[model samples]
Target: MKQMREKRQPADGRRKSILSQLKEAADPIKGNDLAEEMQVSRQIIVQDISLLKAEGQPIIATSQGYLLLKKAQSHTITRIVACNHTVSQTADELTRIVNCGVTVLNVTVEHPLYGEITRSLMIRNQSDVRKFVKNLEKTGASLLSSLTDGVHLHELEADTAENLELAVQALKQAGYLL
Candidate 1:
């Protein structure tokens, strides 16, 4: 992996290096930085990422950058809560949940034709919620709940069962949980 930092690696070498870097990263790594380090264009990095993902890599593109969603972490209590609300209530619902010291890991909604649709959020704080909401507005993208007419599910995580219960109670009080 150290050799990856020296200069532009060969084609095969670059892809291997990129994979190594992603696997070693504790946080998302920006494409531009990856490209610069590999002495390649951002577009090239994007293509490489696409190829990597197509090959079954659990790489997710977040607003911050690219993150590999590996399945090893601290054991936290996870709960899936059913929710029903209009798109306008998204931020409020997320804020309440996060304020209760929970991480909203993902959101899911059942689509009539497409089956279950889920989007990973990895939102741990109000700031993450704000950024997610802002990105939604900026991109003019519709929420998954929009497809299901305001019904969805959130997979929430908390370090303790108590915190998870607090988050669930808050969501219920806010009329976000079903």
Candidate 2:
């Protein structure tokens, strides 16, 4: 009873530290790096993240690492656009959107069995786009869009409605928009 309470103290403290570290980070922090800093296994860090999420923390896992969702600015505009294209066009599609001064928030797809699946991208520029495309090729992993015949939706964010409109128009011109 008392022993169990004492044992949980350290873990609770570690979770608090993890939350603080995430909040302070300007970019997503990799679990491996967090594990090394905390002197714990990566699995332990994963478990901590799960616990934090279960507590209603706004933490998201991205291709690069884990990120804490920030509140959208009052002037920010977001739009979800449907797109269909081959896997090879992913880079081009993302590049076009970012080139229009929009951030690619995430990709969503509807699976027959899973219903709706979404993954955070948090891609803000060409560099992020390059890293995302490179990771896919390096891992030989299939894009979520592959499940639904290259059909997917992207949530895009920009500073103004015009920026969002421009991004959508770009996708439409590239024949990527559905």
Q: Name the candidate that leads on lDDT.
A: 2
Per-residue lDDT of candidate 1, residues 70-129 (tens digit): 884577889999999988899999999899899888888888898988877878888888
Q: Write the per-residue lDDT of candidate 2 for residues 115-168, one digit (tens) a residue.
A: 999999999999999999999999999999999999999999999999999999
User: Model 2 — which ten-residue stretch has the worst lDDT?
Assistant: 1-10
C-alpha positional error of residue 167 in candidate 1 after TM-score superposition, expressed in Å: 0.5
CA-lDDT, candidates in order: 0.86, 0.93
After aligning candidate 1 to the native by TM-score, how far in Å is the CA of 115 from where it should be?
0.7
Strongest candidate by TM-score: 2
Q: What TM-score would every model get versus the actual structure?
A: 0.80, 0.92
Clashing pairs in 1: none
